[model samples]
Target: MSKTVTVEVGLGDRAYDILIGSGLIARAGETISARLPGTRVAIVTDENVAASHLEALKSGLESGGVAVAATIALPAGEKTKGFAFLQEVVDAVLGARLERRDAVVALGGGVIGDLAGFAAGIVRRGMDFVQIPTSLLAQVDSSVGGKTGINSARGKNLIGVFHQPKLVLADSGVLDTLPIREFRAGYAELAKYGLIDRPDFFAWLEKNWREVFEGGDARIEAIAEACRAKADVVARDEFETGDRALLNLGHTFGHALEAATAYDGARLVHGEGVAIGMVLAHRFSARLNLASPDDAVRVEAHLKAVGLPTRIADIPGEMPGADKLLDYITQDKKVSRGALTFILTRGIGQSFIAKDVPSSEVLAFLRDSLG
Candidate 1:
């Protein structure tokens, strides 16, 4: 048995544990049953995840005496995080006659986690939620955050609620089944933790990212560390009211890019967009004299070394114009009262919130970036 590392998100009465390790899916029943006694559940997953992991999860829950009232498998991809899928999950969970005390288990990547969590939040005014995050991105980031929502036609994650999960199960073994591209996409998020405020973690990743990718202790440590970083921030700002917005390090521009591509996975997954956006964030900071150009270079180099796209130009397919991208940025959830708000950095581990940034400056930067 691979060792499991536990990180706690201390939210007082709403506190929860994130368990990271291997074979967690098989042992999930014992854990869930222990934490949420006599709870029935509805499993929400995508078709791809269902084919690969749904049965093992079902068996685990069954063995623990947890009843699965229904299993919902939706289409796979970024597009699945929408109203239609949210409705499908809610309808099924309700159709199963699941009461508020029952649980909703999300059994896929970030999309499923978000969609299922949103369903869990609104159905019967919120049911107990469990996150079984199969993708590296989901395991480290989305699964730990209580922020749940579907993407809007206007912006990413614009429609949702802050419904934290009762438990999170991150089984590294399932990552062996992920494509190299998908794995690389997830690594971008892992690196973001370092860039946010853990320069030492960033440096360690620079020296040991290959081993982290190879799997084993390195990957587990990295995941646990990322979760810990996020847990600390979440505990401090559960509603993203203050320091918590720092968590959106690259998301402002990253989400704009995602919206620009219409959330197309072929052109850009969330992590890849984030990869490019992080580099851009550093470069934009340097452009504003907030950080050194060397910082941008270093960030771009590390991300590129991990096989992530560090430039918007690297995205395949035609991209929208700078004006369109800026328009999308204006619509981002981070924008406060029509004033531009961004998480700009001064260098590694020196991020701060910058509000009232002029739209013209951003427009000029986007034009330069698009060129």
Candidate 2:
């Protein structure tokens, strides 16, 4: 029953709140039932999470007198975010006879949240969606923004929509079950908010990331701060038309690496790819004379200290060639009609969108980075 910090994503009528605290899952029924009023819910989760936390969630909702009309658990991991599983979830929601007002509850990590949210967005033309994010990454990043979708074979998150959730319950206590690697992967995204604009938060993380990793007050504070940063950006640009694109700071290179790896969690998870991609972005900015090399070094040092993979060389197993990697980059969602767009930096906490960057320069950087 620790104090829950609530961050509001203010989108007028479509706005929602992200509640972060311990024991929120056990109390989820009270909150969700209060918000949606007599609505039934369909719980969409993965096999892994269903084993770990599904019963508790069901018990919580049932205790609050909310009926769980159906439960659909899919196989876990990044591959589950595709047409096949999306169809399964859609079918399950329809099979459950859920109405438009009923909620589609995502009770797992980023994979489950994205898949379930997308299902909620499209089923019966968008039903109410609730997110009970279990992973540190999903709690702080994916669970907050309404960017819901599955991955395309072409690229990560290429096939998604702007479907905001009605409410997001982020129980940090649940993160205790996550493997150390998964937690670290999520930290990459938390650190990203600092790198994007909050030099103070970045410096704070540099000094206190150890405590943040150990969990407790430091962890909650970090999650709340990251949520606040994202809430502000998302509130202002829900569709990523301008400043919102900054949220994808390292995603261009990161998503390319993901596509290169074919979205395999073993080789490179999303956040690890983001860690390496952030380093690459800083280094590439320095190469373009847009930022100082010292900035890139500092970013790399912090990421490496935290056990994140900060370089392409850190990825395990065989990697695609630079040409293939370049092709993947070109296919990134940031690319505008064959022109390159990247989030470059002038220094720490000073990221900006650089559009129409030369593809030739990017190709050269990829070649050197491969070496």
lDDT of 1 by residue, 180-295 (tens): 99999999999998999999999999999998899988899999999999999999999988999898889889999988888778889989999999999899999999999999
With a 3 Å backbone cut-off (N, CA, C), the pairs that clash in candidate 2 are none
lDDT of each: 0.92, 0.92
What's the CA error at residue 105 for candidate 2, in Å? 0.5
Q: Estimate each model's TM-score.
A: 0.96, 0.97
Query: What is the lDDT, from 0 to 100, of the residue 350 in candidate 1?
Result: 82
Which sections of candidate 2 miss by over 4 Å? none
Candidate 2: residue 297 Cα off by (Å)? 1.2
Candidate 2's C-alpha lDDT? Answer: 0.92
